[model samples]
Target: MEYIQTVLFQVPASRLEQASETGGLLAELDGHRAYLKQQPGFRDLRLTRSINNEGNVLIVVETRWADDESLVRYETAEPNVAGIIRKHEDLLVRDSLQVLDMEALRTEASFARLESAEAARSRLVLPLIVPLGVLAFALLAIYGLSRIYLELDKGSAVGLATGVAIGILLIAVYVANNPRMPAWQVGGIFVVVIAALAGGTIWALVQEDEGEATGEPTASASPGASPAGSPAAGGGELALTLGDNFFELAGQKSPTLSVAAGKEATVSLTNTGIAPHNMHVADAGGQYPEAFCNPGGATPCSDPNLIKAGGTATIKINLGAGTYDFRCDFHPLEMTGTLEVQ
Candidate 1:
């Protein structure tokens, strides 16, 4: 294996610049190179200087040898690197020097092949990862914002969404203007914003679920009062409110509707939520045979069309005394109720 020796030292920036123009340091190193070339194991020599124009300039001198035995033979010689650098004590920074000896781990050709393979892999992966990461973040942002907005009134939702957008734009502008900002600070800002959005979305959903579970009405009920129980013995007309993913009857979620047997009953549906909804009652056998029920169908009863937010629709129920199932077509699993025909 090859043996390498490295000498590291620092000089005052001003002194290095002056020495370069006057060939002071360069001439001394050239004389030293001539001495090293006459040694038995000398293979190659390199000199490097830091590009940063800071207070001190760092310099590195590296020498390669054929093997450890040859390097050991040269180390015992008289005109060594330490003796050469000692002559320039006035130019170098105080105590800023180090010497290291190392054995080569890999040949130059193998190292080059490894570097080329790593670069190719990076090029292939970065292209796919960047676009996919951007797309996923965009989708998550949209979903989180939608969940938060769904809980607010129209005016509040618009105002909050606009403010959030403006805040994001301002942050983008700040990051663009301060390109030298620390990476950790930028990452912390992103993490805080995303966490805030996720927290708000979760809170909004929890509040909605709590409200639905408590059977709170989103809209005003009819003026006439019926005690909090099943509809009147012979249900003439009953009013129901459709909220987000739920149905409310007289401030009761998924309530049962009772009507006298062989009598006609009318149910008024008022949609107070953002999503469209329609009521569909199953047939006598408690089965919804049709994929899309028609209002004029012979079996189960259903609304002719979906009701938009703040819209209203009516369905007539007339059947033999029995129990039937009813649900909203748009949110069948979440918004369901029982119809009791006594």
Candidate 2:
């Protein structure tokens, strides 16, 4: 079903090096790759060189064709391998050239097996890997952007992000439209993007560290005391504030709040950071029942809705004396606290 033609020759190691420098033997073979691609039924071409036992360099040029007729037609054409060898005879070892024509023995069953393997890989591996890769890239982009936004003022952060985004989009558009863009250009684009992301992230971290050294409080710092004029702990009212990946109450991280048992306590939640947050308190025995909570739910008491950045929500709780675990449903692990009703 397929055909192969191979031409082999040997040249002295020194001659090969000279040919390389003068674009003689190797360059001619490379030129053939493009030329043969224009011929009918040409499938592939490969050129390889190795050192022979006689200390000469053995060069092999192998070409695959769709059928025997195609190989025969190519051999009869002008400027074929035989002609090229004759042109470069002075550089090659005397009486060290051979040409062979062979039939490919690949069976139909082997082709079927290969196709099946490829199909399986497409069905199983690609779907999982592609999504995971996309998710990882998205998370990295988000982290870089968030860091930059945190370290810079709003105008500077917005301008930087917009400029970078526009540049990337333009490059993507150019590459997509050009289809045959040079490899070096693609590599340079990737290098620029990677460097920008890394540089922004590092710059943001350094700025944050300097701010900390200057005793500037971070977003995650405790709220310390209740806001002035806010309801007191004995007044059946409490307030909790949410920061980046953290929950604060009465000047503590994941702190415990006491409420009078069997009395309705109005707890207000405020999101002070740039991420959505909500509080969910588990029922007595610290159990979240399925009927009352959705999958991955923490319920029995929860904000009616998530509080967006700089937004607020109020929830009323009237539970018997018990300590209940509470957390942000969206960020359960990083943001958590306890409510003690006694």
Candidates in order have lDDT scores of 0.76, 0.73
Taking all chains together, the TM-score of candidate 1 against the true structure is 0.38
What's the alpha carbon RMSD for model 2?
20.1
Q: lDDT by residue for model 2 over 154-222, one digit each (tens)?
A: 347679879978987898799889999998997787678777887888987786656544422322332
TM-scores for the candidates: 0.38, 0.33
Q: Name the top lDDT candidate.
A: 1
Window of ten residues with lowest summed lDDT in model 1: 214-223
Runs with alpha carbons beyond 4 Å of true place in candidate 1: 1-103, 106-118, 179-182, 216-238, 243-342
Q: Ten residues in a row with the worst lDDT in model 2?
A: 214-223
Q: What value does the lDDT take at residue 92 in candidate 2?
A: 91
Please estimate how well model 1 matches the true structure, expressed as its whole-model Cα lDDT.
Answer: 0.76
Model 2, C-alpha of 61: deviation from truth (Å): 60
